[model samples]
Target: MIPIRAYVAADFAGVAELWRAVFPDDPPYSRAEVAIPAKLAVQPQYLLIATDGERVVGTASGGYDGTRGWLYAVAVAASHRRQGLGARLVQAVEARLAAAGCGKINLQVRAGNADVTGFYESLGYCVEPRVSMGKRLGVNAGGTGTSGP
Candidate 1:
């Protein structure tokens, strides 16, 4: 059975693996890497993992700007693609954000990624021409995600 849970210390490696499988071109980072770890530790509640019994195959990281919710690092393993794992992870993250009093969720997709853009649109997200402009909270955001990456 597929289970989604809060990111635990033991699941770090699996999460990193999932990230690589989803975005092989990007450099992967260790969970204990100081930068990302510090940021995530402060808001562990916002990081989520999807697993088939301890094997994390999907991940979603959310950032809140004190009002709206921003989603990032959401990726499902290639082997698990198209089985609704991506959508499921987003739903789980958004649910938590809603409960935390976030007004709206915002994300960015690179103009080149048509397939990924379609995925977000199907989930009730519309394209906003505005570019993502923000100072990193000194966090370990693997890449920019205006919507889902």
Candidate 2:
């Protein structure tokens, strides 16, 4: 198994290809070309990838928000699944979050993606009763980037 490492600019194409294959339902804005740079602008170190020599085979990203941490984009290529890469990816993010003083970590699996619930559960994650919500900052369609606007 390839050891996981931080993402590099050179890994862009491979990562993009891997994500397109793994998450075919993601929206346009979430495409690797758009999302990768946005993430790099912030906490790039938390963005990790596993590669087989030159091909990206896995990816996982984490975020620390002082009080809570989030695990995002945890995916392994279908060809690479069932070989413990998924578990390792999650564990890498968990280790980083723990190092940053995060006591709790949160992740959301789409309601339709029940198959992944068990995968996450095996990593010690549980489905909490709290509702998940989000608003893309600075976006159109009613949001104006101001709380009072």
Candidate 3:
């Protein structure tokens, strides 16, 4: 099994590349330069990466608000998909959140991302009756997200 472990300083570049390929539609604020430092300032340990020795092929990060856990930035390289790496990345984050006293976990997938819905369902995630809404605050307000790469 490929090792799933906490993120390290060296993972930034590898992760940036992995996400760029895996999630081409990701918003700017969620870019590596912004997200990495922001995550490191928070519960950094929840950021997990799947590595084959020196290459980062998968990534997932979680957050525990003391009640419900949040999952974000889950991605696996195109070549690594269908090999159980995505599920493993998510499971690793779930394990960490559970250890932190999180009773339930929540994640968001953009509307119409049906392709991945089945994958999450297989992992026991079910759709709930709630309409998701959000408002950008702070630096994300203008949608610039962050400065250039």
Q: Identify the candidate with maximal lDDT.
A: 3
lDDT of 2 by residue, 60-109 (tens): 99999899999989889998998999999989988998998999998989
- Which runs in model 2 stand beyond 4 Å of their true positions? 139-149
- Residue 86 error, candidate 2, Å: 0.6
- Give the per-residue lDDT of model 3 (tens digit) for 1-149: 88899999999999999989987877788889889999999999999999988999999999998979999999988878899999999999999999888989999877788978888999999999898877666867674534322
Candidate 3 or 2, higher lDDT: 3
Badly placed stretches (over 4 Å) of model 1 are 27-35, 134-149
Which segments of model 3 are wrong by more than 4 Å? 143-149
Q: Give candidate 1's total backbone clashes.
A: 4
- How do all models score by TM-score? 0.81, 0.91, 0.93
Error of 2 at 49 (Å): 0.4
Per-residue lDDT of 23 in model 1: 64
